[model samples]
Target: MSNGPAGHVARSTVRPNYETGRRGPIRTFLRSADGILIDSVYDPGAVVYGSAENPADAGRSPTRDLVFVVAHGFTGDVDRPHVRRVAGRLRAHGAVVTFSFRGHGRSGGRSTVGDKEVLDLAAAVEWARGLGHVRVATVGFSMGGSVVLRHAALHSGTVDAVVSVSAPARWYYRGTAPMRRLHWLVTRPEGRLVGRYGLRTRIHHRDWDPVPLSPAEAVPRIAPAPLLIVHGDRDGYFPLDHPRMLAEAAGDHGELWVEAGMGHAENAADDGLLSRIGRWAAVKAG
Candidate 1:
């Protein structure tokens, strides 16, 4: 790994290992449709076998069979420990690709928060496809949850499956302390400054030119490709109604799991829950 712009860690790109019939880890920057450079990493999965290993490694498959592209929440990047933990868990099922949305890490441009982030995810998914994975699944958290919903709707049939966690059903105004503070964090100059210095997230000064599609509206369009909505019943950001709305919109094509004691997004998702999600992705992609 080498130091990238603004003193962020950046990994070097490596060629795929053809001899092993697997791809090597590749670290590179991807260009969003709007031209923002997104910092990304592709990790090949570790080899695993059934209880008894056969001469041909019977139940084992190559690392590139499926790829999970992880999209993190607001104020999150590919390098965050929580994000890394999530990626590490998914690696048990298949290859993992994680990237920092623009303005979050070494990626260029300011964040419009969630709007236009679809372009960033699109770029990452396109890159994952180019890596030659047989299947691709998108796993997103919080702000990224909203992004993945919009992305799957916007680019129908592009991804094989999608998992959204702790996403809002619509543009919400909860009057809750966390949601209120979060609004302030994105809407005010002082909050933006704190975000830049304290959180290392740069907020864009401008608002959406044309308001982007909301998660509720997007969910109805995500059919044909599998959708899984995972939210915490005790989530501080959004409540049970949010996931219910999304699942209702999704109709038969979507599945909802409201964890009993979970809180919110990546920080709240435990190892066992993440393992279950990884396994679900592996099955859906298969």
Candidate 2:
């Protein structure tokens, strides 16, 4: 690991008996629209056991032909355990690119919550495409979920498929305790201070100059490119109506899955669920 300007860090590892002759996962910083240096990592999928039923040539096929760009939720970065786990599971289906949004982890700038996050996701998606992957799918959770939806809508034809989990359909929702607390966390100076110190996330102290499009409004423009909306039935944040509204806006092009007994975002996503999502993205990209 080596550190660079503006809190950027690059990390890679060497493996023995390497056949691909490629270096370890590439880690670097990408510049967002507003000049924020977004920390990112790209992992070229290695051969892994495909399925229990197929043993002979199961691990021979590599998933590097496709790419999945993963965007994490609020306060989550590429290095977080849950984020790493999500990336690991998706590697079975394709190459994985994960990034830390502005104001999170080592990335510079303050979070506009989800308002300006579309640029962050856009940067990551662009970086993924630059890596020579023919197909790219974006998967995001919570705030990052909203970011992916808006990014896909704003930059048409940039992504092949999109998966948004536990995202709010509209903004300014405070129906639940967590949402209420989150609003407090993003709306007040004290809250921003707490977020910066306690959560390691820096919340911008100003309101959106011109409020961005809501996720529900953005979903309509994402057609032709497949979309998957996954929300937990028991989610404490935004409830099922959020996903329902988003899916409804997406019409025939969108698929909705309301997982029972699940909660919120990436931390609540199990390995089985992640694998299923990865496979779904790979199939959709095909």
- What are the per-residue Cα lDDT tens digits for candidate 2 across 1-286? 3333332333333332257544357777777766787888888875565577876646453433678999899999989999999999998888898988899998878898888778888878877776667899999999999999998999999999999999999999999999999999999889889999999899888888788999999999998999999999999999888999999999999999999889999999999999999889978986
Off by over 4 Å in 1: 1-12, 49-61
Superposing all C-alpha atoms, what RMSD in Å does each candidate have to the true structure?
A: 4.1, 4.1
TM-score of each: 0.91, 0.89
lDDT of 1 by residue, 47-152 (tens): 8765554656566564647889999999999999999999999998888999999999988899998997898898888877777777999999999999999999
Clash-forming residue pairs, model 1: none
